[model samples]
Target: MNEYKIEDLLFEELILMDQEASDYEDLITQIGELAFEKGYVDKEFSKAVIEREKLYPTGLPTNKVKVAIPHAMVRDNVKKSAIIISKLKKPVLFKEMGSSTDSFIPVDIVFLLAVNGSKDQLTILQKLVGMFSDDDAMVKLNDMKTASDTIGVLKEILSQ
Candidate 1:
């Protein structure tokens, strides 16, 4: 079996900018297609994530910047663990996480997750959230000049 480190969950092919999604659903679908193409997940992953977001949104209002960490049921069809990091040219509205009220937030960044199991999901999530919460990280993400720059920052974030 292949050893799955945090690094394993990240690929240069999976990172990109200018997602150009008008809404949350479109954003999720676009990332899902990429995830499928990269052999990280199946087709059902995107649909599941879209539906899941309706019930339990992952729109996190962080200190640095707002981001959505959307995911779906992965126990069955996940071929590999990977995160598809996408940047929105224009922010899209999404429901807030764990809110009793029907609160919505504008998410500038989206982290579409496809992990093999619960452990990997939680581990990467914790790390990703930690890095996303930093003002410096957010700044770097916004000012990234190239795909490799974003990939480099993601690698460093995962290392920490």
Candidate 2:
């Protein structure tokens, strides 16, 4: 796995807290565009992420909050191994991970990953999954008031 510091992958400009979107696609596209402008991903990154989400849903129904991890594996499009943390203003419908298409959940947060390496993707995903499974952590994340504050807490949790 590629060794990376959590802080390095996180950008203040990429963090979206209390954002409103019509749906998952809109949400992903909005964030993707921001990342692309910042040189973190290519132009096709958002479309690819939407297509990937359609085939393999990434939503997780945790104890306190429901979250989604949306990403694509187009290595060339990923300029850097970065993460966009978006806390939606209202919940959006998302098909649950590993579940049937009809099995949908309302996702309050979206973790949009743009990782260039497969190993790095899996490593960051594992850390995120562990964090999501923790009820206290989920609640804290859901209640976080500021993006920078949330980033600090995430760095502390995911750095391990």
Candidate 3:
């Protein structure tokens, strides 16, 4: 579990404060390109994520804020263990996680996870779920005005 620090996996460069996307696929593509260009993920990362979302949606409908945690298997695709946090300009529809079908939600935030392996992914997902369940934390994230502010809030919540 000590393979990587939660705070260390966050990069200021990957904090997308105001992202605009027509749909979830577009959002993932934009974020994926950023990560790929930064050498964090491979070229096929975005496509893989989209496919995975179709089968196992990551859309999480939290109490205060709707969010999504999208990711693909590492499988040598991730060059670095970094999370790309994107605050969309507007909410986008996503199939809710654990839904059989016909269940969707408008997501305000996107957490594009580019981690090392299954172990790290599960650990980060647990931490993220805890953060999402916190009303105060989700509200704070929603109100963040800058990328650095987002990082600060995430570091504080994720560290706990």
Residue 110 of model 1, lDDT score: 86
Q: For model 2, how big is the CA root-mean-square deviation?
A: 1.3
Please provide the root mean square deviation of candidate 3 (C-alpha atoms, Å).
0.9
Q: What's the lDDT for all of these models? A: 0.81, 0.87, 0.90
lDDT of 2 by residue, 44-141 (tens): 99999999999999988887899999999576789877999899889988889999657888999899999988887887888889989988878887
Clashes of 2: 0
lDDT comparison, 2 vs 3, better candidate: 3
Candidate 1, which ten residues in sequence have the lowest lDDT sum?
1-10
Q: Residue 130 in candidate 2 has what lDDT?
A: 91
List the candidate 1 regions with Cα displacement exceeding 4 Å.
Answer: none
- lDDT-wise, the better of 1 and 2 is 2
> How high is each candidate's TM-score?
0.91, 0.95, 0.97
User: Candidate 1 lDDT, tens digit per residue, 1-160?
Assistant: 1357777776888886877887899888888888888888888889989988988899998776789999885456578877888877888888999998989989888888887778778887888888877888787776776778888877776677
> How accurate locally is residue 70 in candidate 1, as Cα lDDT from 0 to 100?
92
